[model samples]
Structure formats: C-alpha cells, structure tokens
Target: MNCLQSVGHSRFSALPWPKRVDAHHRRTAVFNGFVGTGSLRVAAMKTSSNSRSSLYEDETEEQASSLDAKMTDLSDREEKSEIYSSNMTQAMGAVLTYRHELGMNYNFIRPDLIVGSCLQTPADVDKLRSVGVKTIFCLQQNPDLEYFRVDINAIQQYSKELNGIHHYRAEIRDFDAFDLRMRLPAVVSKLSKIVDINGGVTYIHCTAGLGRAPAVALTYMYWVLGYQLDDAHKLLQSKRPCFPKLDAIRSATADILVGQWKARVTFKWDGDDCSSVDISGLDIGWGQSIPLKFDEEQGAWLLERELPEGRYEYKYIVDGEWVYNSNELVTSPNMDGHVNNYIEVFNEDVNIEARQRRKKFMDGDAELTTDERKMIRQFLDSYKDDADLDEEEAEVRASATSDAIASGTIGVPDKA
Candidate 1:
C-alpha cells in the first residue's frame, strides 16, 4: 500500500481504549475488501458503529504525510530558485559596478585612454565621437535622480550614430559590493571581446574618474600590460594623477590588481644563474659594496639580477672606475632624480633597511665589507644609470673619488 494508506491504518490502530473493538472493526473492513476512496468511507462507517473514537485521526495522518511530501518538493524548488536569483543578482551587480566606474564623462579625444572631468557631460560625448569610440559603457545608474533611471532612447541614438555597441548597467539596492577578484575576469573578458570585434579604442569612465573607472583601467593594465599592483598604481597615477582616494579602495584595488596580474603574467630568466648572497650586513652609502659568491662557470657570467624589494642607493664599479648601470630598472627616486625600483614581499619579515642601518652604525664608516661590496657592485652593474655628470658635479665626484681611494674604501684599477 501507499504511504498514505499505511499511515491511515496506523492511525486507526492508535485509537484510545477501544483496543478490542478497534481490532474487530479493522478485521471487518479488511474482510469487505475495502479499496479506493469508497473503501475509506466504508471503513469510517464501521469505525463509528463500534467506537466513538475520532475518525478524523486516520484522515489527518494521511493528509499530514501528503503535506510533508509536498513541503519537501516545494523546498527543493525554492532552493534552486534562490540559487538562480542570487547568481543573477551578482552578475547584474558586477556589470553595474563596471559601468559606473567607467561610464562617467568619458572623453574620446584620447582614444587610447578615457579622460573625464566628472562622471557625465556633453563635451565628453563629443570627444567620444571625435575619437571614434565605438562602445560607451555607462556605469551611472541614474543619468537622472533614481539609480534605475537611464536614458535608453539617448543611448540608442548614440549607438545608431556610430553603428557601434552601447551598454547601460545600473547598481540596484541589495546589490553585492564591488569585488575586484570576482569582477576582473568578466571585465577583462568583455574588453577582449570588444577589442576583437571593433579593433578600436574602448573608453571606460565613471562619475569622478576616481574609483570604478580607475579600477577597471587598472585591471586592463594588469591583464594587458602585465603590470604588478604597485607598478600599475604608479602608471595610473602618472596618467590621471587622481585615483582611489579612500584607503580601502586603494587597498582593495591593489589586492585585486596583483591577484589578476599573478594569474596573467609569467616570468622567465634568459641569462646565467648565480649563487645567492646576503647583503643584510652592509652600510648605506654611495660606494658601499655587498659580497656575493657564485659557482664559477666558464664563458658564463651573471648578466643581471633583481634586487630584493626596497629602497637602495647604489653605483656600479666597472674596471675600477665607479660607474652606474644605465640598463637597470628602479621604482623610487633617490637623492638624485633617478627612479629606484621597489620590492614588496608578502608576510612579515626582516627589514633590509633596518639591517643596513644597524650595520652602518656599528661599522662607523659606510664602506661595504669585502662580501658586501661585491653584492652591491653586482646590483648596480645589473641596472645602470646614464645621467651624464655635469662640470660642477664632476668636480665634486672627483673629490669624493680621491677621498674614497685614500681611505682604501674603493680599490684603484690596476695599470697594465
């Protein structure tokens, strides 16, 4: 029998104090070959004739079992619906965020980059046409007052003018917060598709050209240019000068950009491999050297190396003359106008600068130890500077050179 029928039988048996009579009633119903709804009615009649027990108990149990099965089915459907709804919401939110970050006051004048005075303006629209910007991604929710308010007709008109693509996404309430990690892939994917189809400039802007616009642009840089988070920030700052005012936005952008960069870019070495050196015991000065000992290989010398991420002041010593490498990459500016590269390592670790400072104080003179000198020299030679010495600077440099030689801080070249 079905679960409903079995539950009905159990309910009839559960009736109070009529143990003998209820058994007799059940036997009479069974002998009559009761079946279907008609049989249930017959069984009810027999039950009433014998005992005044609640006949509704059997019916109630059957109904309860049916209700439970229905509830389970409903629950499964609700779960699936909720999942679909949540996914749809997240996808819509990301699109809206991308548009808001990129759509405001977009200028097509600079086709390669989107220039925005604010988030929206007529001049920007004009510039977009001038630069042959084919796609306009509006991230602003309300070109009017409400977030949902959008200019569908105007967007359609613009699209017709260029016979290009126009997309508008709005950030609705209860929407997910902008997630760089989740959204970057979609943004990059969209950009790549746009570039592939149109092969023209794609301008991205937001209200202030500050938050989302910069973020989307940064993702492009990370994915397209293979820039690390720190490097990408520097590049964007150089281009726009104002981006990511809030610390949280800045931090989040950095994290997302780095994460994307790591996924997209891979590094390869083209030169000979050498031994590792510890320059932690060196003083900070212009001519200090850090020692490095590598396994000797015939016809193969260490061509270049990347220094640990930090600020370092170094000059190359080539053939006994203090020289600077013109080929090395640097991130920050020194006392000189030249830029120095930074190395940002994850995890809390020992400070290279602190170690160098301690070594400087303890050693008195800023001269590099035998081991320290080699490493520092190697670092400088790997990345050289080409700034020509002026007459006045040359004289001062000569004086310093003489002093260094006299103090045995720098070794003189052998005269053959």
Candidate 2:
C-alpha cells in the first residue's frame, strides 16, 4: 500500500473471486518496516519514457543497492508495515487489504513492470492499475477453468472484463531451465509487443510470482537491460527482496550460457529427461554423425569442436526428432521445403571466453568482504562526479583509492 493516490472510477469493475480452494488462505501480505530510509529505496518507478531516476522524488535515495543492506528484523518489519500501509490505504483501497505494504509480496521492477503474485481478485487488478500497470501477463492457469463449472458464463464474462486490462498467457511447463529457455522466445515476443505498441507499465505473474515470473524477468534482465548474470541477480534481489532463491535456475542458466549460437558455435540442448540431443551439422565432421549424448554435468547436450570459420546449416536431433534450434545463429533454405537451422564457426579466443564467463559469475565488488563493500558503498554515496572537492574530500579520495588498490581489482590483467 506504499503507493500514490488511487485512480478515478471507470466502468471497469472489480475482478471476480476465483473458484479455487481457499483464496483467503493464501492472502498475500506486505512488510512495512522492512523497507524504509536506510538500505532499501523507493525510486520513481521505471517507465518507458522516464529518465534514469527522472520520475521518482525519492522519499529517500533513488536506487536500491545490492551491496549494502542490513538484515531485516521482525520488530522493524511490523513497525514499518503499519506506517507504510497507513500511507497506502487510499491507493490500494480494499484490494490490497493486507496489513503490510506490497513489498512483502512483490516489487515494481523499474522502468517497465510490476512483478508480483497472481491476480486473485479484481481488487488486486485495481491495485496494479493504480500504480500504472497497463498489461497483465498471467502464466498460471486458473484452476477453476479446467472443467466447465456451474458459473462458467459469469466467470468468463468477468475474466473478459478483467478491469479492461490487456492480458496475455504463455503456459510454462515445469520449472526446468530447458522449459524456461524454450518458453523464452514467446515470453520475449509478448513483452516486446507491450514495449513496442502499448508502451506502458506491465505486470507479469504466476501462481506465486516468485519462481516462474522471476525466471522470465531474469531473462528480460539479460536481454533488455543488458545485465550480466551477477548484476541481474543482484539487481533483482535488491528490488524484489522476496525474489525466490533460484539456485537451480541460476545454475542451469549459467550452464546453458556455455553454448553459443553464433560463430565458433557452442550449442546446448538440455535433455535431462531425454536420452539424447546432437548437433548434426555439415562441415563439423565426424563425432556428430550419430546422436550426441548429453553430458550430465554440462546441463545440456553441448557441442564445442574446431571447424573452419564459416556458416553451415545444422539441426538438433532430440531423441530422433529433427528440431529447429531457433536461436537464429544461422539458417538456410533446405531443398526439403523447411528452413534449416545453421551454425557459424570462427576462431574465438578460448582464454577470453573463459575470462568473460568468469566475470559473469561475480560482480566487480564481489571479492570485497561484506564490510569492505559496505564501506566502499558509503564512501561512493557521498562522492559525486559533478561536485568540486576541498582538502578533506581530497584526503578521502586518496585513502579510498589506496584501499581499492589494496583490494582485488588492483592485480595484473590476466590474458595468455
């Protein structure tokens, strides 16, 4: 409920109560005291047109930093929740009728979307729109819709209304990296439409908005925000504190990163459940003549072999089915009337690739001890590029620079 004022009423009505077991049982609550003045920040929410910190008059600082946050305590949680909910009452109204602010359950990811729990009621939908949500992407199926219920017409009618919001759904299978990767194109395409056409804020959710939604959001961080994995994970955590600890997904994503779709190809096929997937390509020569067995530790059916630098058409044989890789590394028109997926090979620096991969695993500040990171962040918070400094400022600068030199980054550049 720590939001701006509510919007004027339109013909769009409240959402219907879903006919699922115990909707009340899973009531989402916000944590008030947990987000205030110190580590956590509430910046002007990100939008397509807004400048980097343009819209928000930070009740505090503008950006939430992953480097320095104290552990949130229960007493603080209770205290902050009361103060925040009191402020948000008018905006969230009865829809977000929980005791705490929304951050207990979700975060408004800057610049584009409100990544949060499934819309249980029209009230939640109203709460979202109150904060500039224009589109809703629900990834979970409403359990009530599985069979024709007695109130099917009314339910469908209500869903059609859905507060007059643009809604999309791309059913995700189980939460494996392979499944998520397969679904990425659809997810990206849908979100791209929202950005390209509607150009407003969006909300994407699953049943919990913790796992599936964030998985897709993390993918967006890599694709749209141009964030490496470390930065993306830190940024997501800094924004959505409740963001699920997806070590498996992280491991899978990291593992999957091993494969490159472009020149000097690296192809990965996550066939954990399947028997085999192979990179069958012309010009790669030998080894690929038969279906490739996926290396279990590799997390996918991986192919990294030296081939003369050039383009060549290829396809993945997954358990005997000829599947298009669709990564668009390369493609060609086949005589068989389908476009063949292809690969390109070029001399790549193995050492550089290794170093780049290593860099993705950790942020620049990762090597610093927690306390050192906090100290550096504090010093940086006061240091600004625009400001002119006097003697005291000069001393602080010199000392901080020396400390950095003593830290991990001051070492020799490694390339061999």
Candidate 3:
C-alpha cells in the first residue's frame, strides 16, 4: 500500500506485544507463517492456547475471574514497560522495523540529498552513515524531539564518536508555515555549505518529513539550483511523497510582490482647467489610469501612492492627449516604443522619515536649483544607459558611485 494506510495499521502494533490482546494473538500467528526479524522481539502470551481453552471449559467461575484479573495485571505491566522503556537497542529495533513496514520515512530527492523524518534513536545515525550519508540536518524544534522521544544528544554524540558524521539542527517548528519561511534562508545556506564541504549525501529531516523539510528542499532547488519554482516542486514531488507549502517557499525567496517596501511617489502635471488628468504606465499597467486630483494649494494636478522599489515609466494624459515632461529627471523607452518620464524607487528599510527625504530628492518632490536638478538628471540618464551590465559588476560600480556622490565627486572613470 499506501504509506499512510500502512502507518495507521501498524503505528500501534509495530512494537512486539504493546497490547495484551495483540500479544495473545501472536502465538497462533507465529505458527502460520509469521516471521520475526532479529531487530524486533515478538513476545508471546505466557499461558498456552490449549490451557486457555481448558481453563474456560473445566475451571470454576472464581478461577476464571482470577485468571482474567491476572491477564489484566500482566497487560498493565507490559504497557508500563513499553512506556518507560529507554533501551536504545529495543527502540532502534522497533523504529527500523516500523520504517521497513511503512516504507515512507526517507528518500533521495537529489543524488547528494536525502530528506525525511527525524532519527528516532541513536543507532539510526549509524544506519544512515552506512548508506554514505556524511551529514544529518534535522529541522525539529525541541518540543517535537521530546514528544517523539528522540534522544538528540545521544544521536549527536554517537554520530561524532562512532562515525564522524556531521549532524546539524535547525529549530523549525513543525507545521508553522511562518516560522519555516523565516528560517529557510539560514537553513538552506547551512545545508548548501555542508554539502559542498562534505561532498557526500546529506540527510534533511523534520518530524514527519512532509512540511518544513520538504519546503526547505524545494526552496534550495529554486534559489540555489536555479530551478523554476514550479519545476522544483514537480521534481521534488516526483522523487518523494510530500506536501510542500509553496507560499512559504515563495515568501522566503521574495518572489511575491506583496510586503516589500514601497516608496511614496507623487506624479505632478502642471496644467489649468483640464477635463481629466491621469497618470498611466507600466507600474499600474498600460491603458489603466489613476486620476490626479487638482491640488488647490500647489496649483497642479497630482497623484500620490506607494510604489515598490523599481524603475517605472509613466506619462500624463492631459485631456485625452499623451504628454511627457521633457524636464523630467529620468526617461526611458516605453512599451509603445515611445520615450516617457521615469523615476527610480530605491529600496529602503523601516525608517519612514529617511525614506521620505530620499524620495523627495530622487523623485523631484523637493525644491532644487536648476543646476542641481540637471546634475541629478545626468547621473540617472547614464545609469539607465548602462542597465545591461552584469549584476555583480554593476553593484560594485553603483556602490562606488554612491560613495563618490556622497563625497561631492561628480564621476569616476573606469580603470580600463
């Protein structure tokens, strides 16, 4: 079967004699082709079936009652032993056998990466190491480990001392999508580093290997391996059964446009008694217009809204006629193959006042001398012309230019 159906069938009965009734039935089943492995100890009931039958037929009512009480007492003791048992060997045996029967704990997503459930016991580390796993990356929080009875310290110690295997842990709360997204970067970065350094298989796991662990793996494929988000999900699901949260992975990678910092942009059209003045461009989709209200105080038509950090090309429609501000600081070719007024919205953190001040200067929202505006316009023009440069080289040049501008330098020439 189905992996979940198998797990539901065996979760309680996986261990030998966890229940008294199951224990009693095992004696008859053992003779009927029921094979037990060396790892698991299949215990049988102390009283034989023949004796049980005889006791029911020949024994007094009081004796039968006494036997029933004795069996109940035996069951209570067995249950206690099962709960209080800390024997690593027995736990490993049960975990291994359970994993074998269920057939869905772990699988190789990539040749170098195996993703699945947590290591249930210390010996699991050794078993994994035998399969050429040089690193074990766990994504369980402390409560999950305790609830699953996973002796993390023992596993770590055994991995280091017995096999020199590297074990790393990220405290990603199980089933919490927000926490998974927040912690994905550090976890993926660390996993990538370990895989590069170790050069062997890395086992990544959360509690059930379904949600958090799979999300991380999928994001790694998308962010690091350069797989498209959908393609990465398809490849991962093909390798192993999982329910990865795509939203969580997308959020971590900044693929969605929501939640980013937006700079307040004000579009101004200086005109008198226009029937309708509208601003239209790529930022708000072509042909769609946001109407600009006449500002009685500033004596102009103005539209203001927050726009995400990016370059946008927009033009004014003054009474149904397309118009461009020839004096605008920035201009770029539009989708309709016409030159249009543009502005650069820079990325900013949570400092609202600082962002507003920068926006005023860069977007021409503040008063500036004619010469100062011309200088600013020239830098933007040059920057747009060099847009096709490699990203790393552009970043270095941009940073150097920013510093030079702050130090009152006009421009710096390239070395060669």
TM-score per model over all chains = 0.31, 0.35, 0.44
* Overall local distance difference test of candidate 3: 0.58
Model 1 lDDT, residue 160, Cα: 44
**What's the true lDDT of residue 96 in model 1?**
18
Error of 3 at 208 (Å): 1.0
Which candidate number maximizes TM-score?
3
- By TM-score rank, best first, the candidates go 3, 2, 1
Candidate 2: regions farther than 4 A off:
1-105, 141-164, 242-416
Q: Tell me the spans in candidate 1 whose CA falls farther than 4 Å from its real position.
A: 1-111, 115-124, 142-153, 164-178, 245-416
User: What digit string (tens of lDDT, one per residue) describes model 3 on residues 198-316?
Assistant: 55688888866766788888876665555666777778889876777565555444412123466787778886778789876635434256898998888888888886554556667
Error of 1 at 23 (Å): 92
Clashing residue pair totals per candidate (backbone < 3 A)? 32, 12, 0
Q: What is the C-alpha lDDT of each candidate?
A: 0.38, 0.47, 0.58
By the TM-score metric, which is better: model 1 or model 3? 3
CA lDDT for candidate 2: 0.47
- Judging by TM-score, tell me the better candidate of 1 and 2: 2
- Candidate with maximal lDDT: 3
